[model samples]
Target: MTDDLRLVDVESKHLDDVYRVRSRSFGLLSAGDREEWLSDVQGFIDDGRIVGVVDGDELVAAARIWAFQQWWGGRKVPMGGVAGVVVAPEYRGRGVGSKLMRGVLARSVEHGYPLSALYPATTVIYRHLGYEFAGGRFRYTFPAAELRSLGGKEVSVRRAGPADAKRFLELVGQLHAAARISGPLVWPEDKVAEWLGEENSFCYLAEDGFVVYGWQSGKLRVEELVAGSEATARALWSVVGSGSSISADVEAYMSPDDPAHLLVNKEADKNTVIEHWMLRLLDAPAAISARGFAPGASLEVDLELDDSELAANTGRWHLSVSGGSGSLTPSTSTGEVLRLGSRGLSALYSGTPLATMRRAGLAWGGATAGDGAIDTAFAGATSYMLDYF
Candidate 1:
């Protein structure tokens, strides 16, 4: 049965079939918004971004790749955000999902994306395909009243529209760079336009920050709240709290150490939900070379990468870093090798501490001398993703 399966690019005609498989795999779609959801899925199909596994004419499994520019060590790195992974119920346990993901990895490299990330429904399948837990989307819930008293001089904020896309992108770039953020995604112009056009979404732009939010069932939901300055953070969060009388609580996607939490005057019930995200390096050399490291720092390390899925990544490599830049070359000399698989390497690339990887058994067999330099070169702020797809 596996021999009969073939992976193919999903075309316009396959949209309905793909949706059926997705609905079945993810459970029933909402009756009211099915058409809107289908339209969104069709857009991905029309863009030639969806891949599917077919068993003779039936779409057995599928996934979509979202073009994104994600930050790493203060630089925007091209990222392929994988989502909508679904397999026909009948195809479960048949290895269809694995094949589909392998195809996605190959296509991502073809598209020139050095890195890829996904919020995984389960870790088993992606882990087998060389993806590792690298970051998370952290959701924080607190009473709106607690934020109302956050005191700060109000900065001027204006409603934002598509006209502000370029400026918005610039602001986000500057903010992420300053914060040394990792895993925050930057959308393409078309996506930015779509986001600005959302009827229910509210967007506010300040000189050094921005906030996008919406309402759901009488609760205020902040889709994103990015502030490059403390004053901006307090002001924007205060705006969210301005609705406290009508909305009981506010839930927002935020960094683990966001400053807005400190501005609140009163303690409220704080709940943090972590949705784990996995990452993969599609092109090991290019991915490493493209990353931005610590400024005025330098180091050298040898790595022995084991990538059964992508043979090009297998073998020993020498990495050199200087002044926030890096280069990777094939190594001939035998030395103390950091023995790791593709997943482990990816985790390290995303700033996952060497100590944690060591405890998790993702890394070992390295010379102890270079470990501190390796850590310093890659270490920065905690990595987190605010976007779901």
Candidate 2:
């Protein structure tokens, strides 16, 4: 059924067709809503991001790659965030979605993005394309009053707007570096302005931290809270709980090791809603070299990667690490080989322990001796993403 379809870069004129396909794939959209959606798609097309599968003149399926920088072991790495995937209702069972995703994967490699990530509505399709479940955006809920007891010296914070975009990015970079995070998205300055201008949202900036939140059903909902220092962490969290008298609960997106959790007075019921996200290594060598490893850890191991989608990644690789840095080289040497599929390797790259992968049947064979070293080299704080899409 996909034999007659052609994959191409979506152009400005294709916005209407793209919107129609998305609306039908997702659900009905009002005229006003369609215009708003088309505007966003047009922005992506103008930047040469959207890829579409066309049957003659009709856009039957589409996907977009959001240019992003994601954190890995405290280092920022280029990431292609896949989103806005849609297949026409009539074409849903004809393999159009998979064909379009393959096109997107190829485009990601050509663009030099070593890694790719996405919040999946369904895992089967992405997993088939060599993407594996890697991390999550955790949502936590607790009483606002619990945060009132956290103590800190007063730190001055002021309202922030688009003008503060640069400072906000800098602060988040600092915070992520210190926390040694994984899978957090870094937005461009212009996009920061758009976020600050969102209706009903409130943003505050401090010397070393920032908080963006809004009201939801009379409760405080924090979209993001990044702090580089203890004082900043306490100050920002206190602000969220300051309205405890009126708002009963506060829900926020946070890392599992968020400092605010430690500051609370009682054992609050923390509901961690894990929104699963997947990862794929478009360029294995580049991805390996770009990632940061544990300090004082060193290892050398051979990997046999099985990647059916990207031929360049399917082979034996010699991975070496020292002093929190790593390098990868194509190898013919028959050393202790750790065999796994591309999806499994992507999961391991995101700090999933080698032992866990073996137990899950994603990894096995040769050099059981290197398991500890592999674990230590990739180990870091838990991975989390605060941004969706």
Candidate 3:
């Protein structure tokens, strides 16, 4: 009956079955916001990147992934964002979801994607599937003591509207590209309109449009500081300093290298560090070559990936990169190779310090702290999924 649980590419005939599966799995159908729920499902189908688990003639489980442009060092890297992952109650825990994920990841590689990212519903599930928590969302309060430390200078703040949508999108794209990591930059037209309509949510342009950032006030207190440069980002941050009454709410991931990261440290209060964006390398060779490389000599890296489902990526690969131009090939070298588990690799993929992983007791065998090429190649990268898939 294992073949009965076959994973297949969704087709036109499976729409109704897939819809019913999604409805039963997520409990979104006939729930509040019917229109929104319907739209989400239809949008995924329209985009045509969904995979399903079939049991005989019935579709029992479903997962959705979208291919989009992600920013990486002034270049738009193709990314496979996995989301809407679901399984019916009957099919739950039977490896159906995992099978779906593997299929999707394989498709990502076939489609020439270097990196595949996800904001996981459960981090642990994705871990075994070869995903690791690469980034953290720091939720801090806008405490009174830290108030003075912010907003010292005046920043010309302006409201963003439909007219500014194109520029806002462009600026955000630029910011993500320069950061060498994907930021949640892609927004559908509807989401963009809703964001524009929200009164408390305002966009601030800095340095005569050097950057554009967004902030939201109220129960879901949020601040998204997107900018082209650190100086412009800091200038935009000053605009929010005027609001002293804003109590500590949820503050999402602001880059650790950014001025906001520095200010948050100076004003750290009761905060929770929630992990965001789980990543799995579909093709170690492609993933490495997809991003920009350091300006240096070539270094040979042997990466052993543990993917039970995808046969092509499961073995040892010899990667060669010179100033970032590289090729990955299966190594016939039977010599001792560096071994890294999925979690370690995912952490490494997102620019997490190799030392930090060691400190956390996550071991990378045959590779030492002195291995600067591999370390820099792994840690020099960062990714943010700017879009909700």
Cα distance off (Å), candidate 1, residue 169 = 1.3
Give a tens-digit lDDT track for model 3, residues 169-250.
6666665555555444456565665666566566665543432233445422334666555445555555544344553433
Estimate TM-scores for all models: 0.93, 0.95, 0.78
* Model 2 error, position 115 (Å): 0.8
Cα displacement (Å) at residue 48, model 1: 3.4
* Candidate 1 lDDT: 0.84
**How many residue pairs clash in all the candidates, one count each?**
0, 0, 9
Clashing pairs in 1: none
lDDT of 2 by residue, 64-130 (tens): 9999999998888999999999988888868888989999998888889999999898888999899
lDDT of 2: 0.86
Candidate 1 local lDDT, 273-297, one digit each (tens): 8998999999889888878888867
Question: In model 3, how many backbone clashes occur?
Answer: 9
lDDT of each: 0.84, 0.86, 0.62
Cα error, residue 68 of model 3, in Å, equals 2.8
- Output the worst ten-in-a-row residue range by lDDT, candidate 2: 263-272
Q: Compared to the true structure, candidate 2 yields what TM-score?
A: 0.95
